[model samples]
Target: MSLTIKNLSFSYPDKAVLKNISLSNLPKGKLTVLLGPNAAGKSTFFRSLAGLVDADYEQILINDESLSELTAAERTQRVCYMPQIFSTQAMLTVFEVVLLAQKQLNSWSVTEEDVQSVDALLKQFEIEHLAQRYISELSGGQQQLVSICQAMARSAELFLLDEPTSALDLRHQLQVMQRLKDETQQRDVITIIALHDLSLAARFADNILLMKDGKLQGHGETEFMFSSPLIEDIYGIEIELFRNSKGSLVVTSELK
Candidate 1:
């Protein structure tokens, strides 16, 4: 499966946000990281993909099928989106939220397989202990994890996550990225994540989509997109790229 966006654009009454953004053939079974400075429209782009915002585009296609043509139920079944902010006021257990998400996407009839699936997801995120805990009572990081679990519970062709690791600590950040990568590959789904941490993105992303001022600045494989010139031009800073002993790309930056 793949995603294609042609001449995509969006605007608020006050100002334009995305300006004729066009991306082609974003492949499935890979983790693509969306990088940008604040107000860069990364969130807006994800929202457009999720059909949460109205945007004009020549086409937004999944496997040659127009995403815009899909019904609300069809879109929900095909696209799973986890926004930066998650609702915490829901007086439900972590397990319930995840299970409900799955049921909403698939069927209302609860099955033993569904219950097991929720349990496995909770265990996968190491949050099985929080299964019985109320969402409102969890910490921010815990809530973030639960939100991700909720997203993971859904079986969708496309996954769009915005700043999923913002509330996570160092360890959980690594854990979440690793799990996301694994899930993307195992499920052969298209996963696009918006992130601020360059190092984390470099370490984990299979592809990079960089944006600035509501426009796409660059898109390519991880190594090719992390060149000093592109990094400096996009962020307006001096930067260095090198390989660590493990051969992982490392980026260091300084104000110009």
Candidate 2:
């Protein structure tokens, strides 16, 4: 699977959110990280891909098929997008919510496979205990993990996750990233995640797409795109990367 975008632009009557942005072919079996500051059009771009926002001139092709021509149901079957903010006030249990999402793309009647799959997914995130818990009773971090499971249950070819680990603690954040990487490779899904944590992006992303001022500043391998100069330019903060005792790349911002 692959996604190609060309001459993509969007506006909101008062101001432009994305300027003539274009990205080359983004192939499957890899996690691509979208990094940028706030209000930098990262979420807007994901909205367009999810068919929530209208584009002025977008030629988005998924596996050579035109995304713009697909119907709402067709898009849902092919792409799963998890927004940054979500309401956790639902009265349904975690398992029920996931079952509902699966039913949307599959059968209405719950099957043994569905039950087993949801159970396993919850276990993967170490949240199996929350399966029967009401969604309204879970904390923000728990809800986020449940939302991620809902998106994963769809098994879409393209997964667009915005700030997926925003509310998680350090341990869960690492777990989520590792799980996403393993799932992406195993399923051969084209997973694009919008992240503010440059260190995590650098550690997990197979490729990186940097955006600034509604435009793509760079797109390539993580090692090539992640440079002090580029980070300083895109984030407007001087930074440096160093190998810790564990030989992991760590990003540290330098105050001017």
Candidate 3:
């Protein structure tokens, strides 16, 4: 029950983003947050999981089985990759938008089983009332919720979410993150979330993978990853970490 990457390395046209990164065993059943600065290769690393780009060297193993031999369709079904943001231009309703996410099914021609599944997902995000609303017409936050419902419908064992709450407000940010955690826990799905919000990451993530300059600087529990020096070094700004009465990690800006 793990995704193992050995000596993983990748790069773009003129530069490398990941350099000889080796993670022997990444724990399952946790929200693994990949944190990094702009152009730090977090996106590259996430994309490489699904073969979005060529990894010069890497041995990807899922649940002890090597993905080297799995077909494209096989990989897509086993591991779902939700990009930083999804765009939809079709004149479709909220329900219709989510139905398209079930790429395994037709957007307009859904069976009773498909409708049941998608409807349940929509309701989970508390957006069932918007079933008839056009996605393009919805607000940014509303659309993000719809996208979340769509992603959850994939029902894959592993969910790769990039900036899942980037456009969400403070309340929705927490709500979505919490919901994501609940859904993953209930289903025992491994979630690797690409995030920039250190406070939210500290609060919700079970484990944190710190990346800087395209290298995996550290990987461990949220508390360990947010050490004063580590946070300051990574963000080039001083920050403080404290514990709330609720036992959640609170990140504060520490003046240098």
Candidate 4:
């Protein structure tokens, strides 16, 4: 099960956002990182994939099935999108929010499996201690964790997360990416995350999708993408890329 996007384009009334972007053979069971500077249309691209925007595309295929053909409910069943900004105003407990996500497309009655799934997600995220607390009461990082739990509670073939680590500390950022990678492989799901951290993207991403000015600057394996001069071109900065003694990719940047 792979994903393919062909000739995708989008625009607002006064401005064009995406311009004939095309990518193919985005393999399943791997983490793909979307890398770009701010206002590079990363969020808009995600919204298009989630069917939240009316983008023009020749085809958006998953497992060779056309995403445009799927009804709203069907698309929801296949795709789980966690946006960059999430509302913490819901009065529900942390567990309840996750449980609701598990049962979002189902009947009102909850199943034992749903309860168990929600419990497992919270524990996996190390947030079982906050299960009873309301989302409105948690800190930003804690709320982000809960939002992740909610997204993971759902059954889906594709996961789209926008800046999921933006609010997290160093430890939690590592934890979240590690767990996401593990889950993506374990479930054979295609997970795409938009991130600003080049080091993190290089560390965990199997493929890197680079965008600039609403255009696809590059798409390839982590090493290939990072080696390209487009990295500096897109961000308008001078960067040094190297592998540390531990053999992990590291990126250091300075203003040009």
- Full-model lDDT, candidate 1: 0.91
lDDT of 2 by residue, 145-212 (tens): 99889888886888999999999999999999999999999999899999999889878899998888
* CA-lDDT, candidates in order: 0.91, 0.87, 0.83, 0.92
Give the residue spans of candidate 2 off by over 4 A.
105-107
Q: Candidate 1's residue-wise lDDT over 1-256, tens digit each?
A: 5999999999999999999999999999999999988999999999988889988999989867798788988988889899999888989999899999888846668999999999999999999999999999999999999999989998889999999999999999999999999999999999999999988998999999999999998899988888737767888888777899999888777899
lDDT of model 2 at residue 233?
79
> TM-score per candidate, in order?
0.96, 0.95, 0.93, 0.97
Q: Judge candidate 3 at residue 142 and give its lDDT.
A: 87
Q: Encode model 4's per-residue lDDT on 1-256: one tens digit a residue.
A: 6999999999999999999999998999999999999999999998998989999999999878899899999998998999999787889899888988889858988889888888888889999999999999999999999888888887799899999999999999999999999999999999999999988998999999999999998999998888889899989988888999999888888999
Q: What does the lDDT come to for candidate 4?
A: 0.92
Cα deviation in Å at residue 114, candidate 1?
Answer: 1.2
Listed per candidate, the RMSD to the true structure in angstroms reads 1.3, 1.4, 1.9, 1.0
- Residue 29 deviation, candidate 3, in Å? 1.2
In model 4, the Cα lDDT at residue 145 comes to: 93
Q: Which candidate has the top score in lDDT?
A: 4
- Give the runs in model 3 whose Cα sits over 4 Å from its true position: 103-109, 254-256
